[model samples]
Target: MQRAGNAFVDLIDDVFDNYRQFQHSNDFQQYTSWAKQFKSKLSHALNTWIPKASAFVLNLLSKLRTSMTAWWFFLDHPEVPPDNNLAERSLRLAVTKRKVSGGSRYN
Candidate 1:
């Protein structure tokens, strides 16, 4: 029984390890894409948006960049952006709370 439990635990850990690796790789690829777009946008912002509303436009762009990096997007018909930030933040908070609470009985 103990060995079986241990094996199950190890299997779960392996699955999580694989998941983390895959997530990291996928995130890296997305970040590379965003980086390319970021360079172009920076140049465009500097040339056009900066002179007119430097602070406001730059701040908005900064928020947009954060949302982009976080995979934020609307789920409506048109599917806008900057929507996932709250969900991601809440997930992190829940994880933290779980750690503080010494995990759930099911886990």
Candidate 2:
């Protein structure tokens, strides 16, 4: 389990490395090729790993499969961020207010 987790992290790191390169060079053609290859590789990985995965990991993989399009949207649209840090940051104040106010009665 530990080894599989490490391998998965390494694979993601490699993909991110390629993504950074494409971003730096501003090469849409190369990015498109990479995206196709990545989707194939991801599908293969999920198929290969999901069956043997523990329930926790299986749930994660299932969500990944279901939201695959949204997962890679950032690659298709450079303006879309890969991480939700900005969105989370934007919500921090609201979240804090809700917590302090004992949650809002109205949404």
Candidate 3:
């Protein structure tokens, strides 16, 4: 995903990072279809284009665009977090405790 450019990768990154925020929407729909449609476009691009490299790029770009569109569902939902920052920042509590104590399981 990192190889895909920041703008393109951000959507999937947000999806995985902030899945809870987009699981549901004000329209009473889930984000599942967005992901599904994104995948379908990628598949079609790959299958339709004869040149493999061009097809792959076209697919990736298309998927990235669709994923970004899916992010709108998050904006539509007022109850969900803006991003995954809520959960991410919350994790500091555990990390701080670990630092104060001996450490995590590995540490």
Q: TM-score, each model? A: 0.27, 0.72, 0.34
- Per-residue alpha-carbon lDDT of model 1 for 4-89, expressed as tens digits? 33543554454345335544575555444554554455445434543344566566545644564343322111123223466888
List the candidate 2 regions with Cα displacement exceeding 4 Å: 85-107
Pairs of residues at least 3 apart in sequence or in different chains that clash in candidate 2? none
Residue-level lDDT of model 3, residues 1-107, one tens digit each, is 33334433554565554455454443334555554654555445434442433556766655644674464444445365546787889998999999898786662
- C-alpha root-mean-square deviation, each candidate: 19.5, 3.6, 8.7
Strongest candidate by TM-score: 2
The TM-score that candidate 1 achieves is 0.27
- Compute the lDDT for candidate 2: 0.81
Better of 1 and 2 by lDDT: 2
Q: Rank the candidates by TM-score, best first.
A: 2, 3, 1
Where is model 1 more than 4 Å wrong at Cα?
Answer: 27-107
- State each model's CA lDDT, in order: 0.48, 0.81, 0.53
Clashing residue pairs in candidate 3 (N, C-alpha, C atoms within 3 angstroms): none
lDDT score of residue 32 within candidate 2: 79
Q: What is the lDDT of residue 93 in candidate 3?
A: 91
